[model samples]
Target: MILVAADRVLGRGGALQLQIETVAGDAGVEVDAVRARFPDVLALATAVLRFRQEQWLTGLAAAAVGISEPRDRILALFSYLESCFMDDDWRGCAFINGYGELGRAEPTIAALADEHLASIETHLRALCIEAALPPYVADGLSLLVQGAKVEAAIHGTTQPARSARMTAAMLMSVYEPAREDLFI
Candidate 1:
């Protein structure tokens, strides 16, 4: 319950931005209850981030399930991200927001974010290899998706993903001469 409340706090700002009392109120529990579970905000924040990582990997699997084609599978992942950007319940990624807040100040915090990002990179690299494209494609597409998330949050819209997806498709087609069209 405390983790869920802290996750809600994460959308508005960084993970550690909220006070214990605020999180307690959000959790509908007493401050002591929250403290009993979490000795401090840092502990609570770390737990929430860890919780978010599991959810993210699970969602990533679901996003690509039942999709066989390498390119379509990658695009399906991007489209899933598009829908996620549009979701009203969860605005920004917990991992992104965490790094934005902590930066290099905390190694553990940064690792949490890096681990999540590497998971995305792994998925992208797999698809790129499957399509017989250069490994650089995964790196490029990963940056696009990361930037798209920040862009969507800044503009209060999800057009960034659409634009990024188009750019990705074009890049793939341009790099592979045999494929007439990669854009969907």
Candidate 2:
């Protein structure tokens, strides 16, 4: 529903300029000064920065999809996201293009995005350690999970997430037969 709402807003606004202005206004920010001074490209960069910061909170909270426990939150969020973007043309999506468009103009957003991705990757690596997996295998798992996010977005399906889960389970069977550390 949030994605749908965002899509609606994007459709109605027609341009990043309008979207930024509306978003700023919704947040009760006086963007008039910024709007008057910066060109559309500049404003877009600023909006992208703000958008990424906001996304961090959403990502951490698992978008409030109702799974409150940390482990459940991660699984549910990934599961739903996998289901959400499971479209046939997901791969052809312009995620990189859009990311580049935002990054080229907004260095701050680019930097923050890099930081966020790294933080999340570390979180995954820590989970691997908790599962008692070897460091290299844990790193591989972390990369696999991260890569699945991109794959899910590109393929528009939950298959990537499911694949990640299956792969993780297989690795666990080899490295952690007891499943003593896993909560679920």
What local distance difference test score does each model get?
A: 0.83, 0.51
Q: How big is the positional error of residue 16 in model 1, measured in Å on the Cα after superposition?
A: 4.4
User: Candidate 2, residues 1-184: lDDT per residue as tens digits?
Assistant: 2222333333233224335455445445555643554445444544444454455446656554565443344344446445445544333112233445454665664565566556666665655555565656656665665678678665556777788767766665676436556867
Separately for all candidates shown, the number of backbone clashes (residues 3 or more apart, or on different chains) is 0, 6
Model 1, runs deviating above 4 Å: 177-184
What are the per-residue Cα lDDT tens digits for candidate 1 across 107-164? Answer: 8889888988998899899999998788789999999999888888778788988998
Those runs of model 2 whose alpha carbons end farther than 4 Å from true positions after fitting are 1-77, 80-99, 102-106, 177-184
- State which candidate has the highest lDDT: 1
The lowest-lDDT stretch of 10 consecutive residues in candidate 1 is 175-184
Best candidate per TM-score, number? 1
lDDT of 1: 0.83
List TM-score per model, in order.
0.88, 0.55
Clashing pairs in 1: none
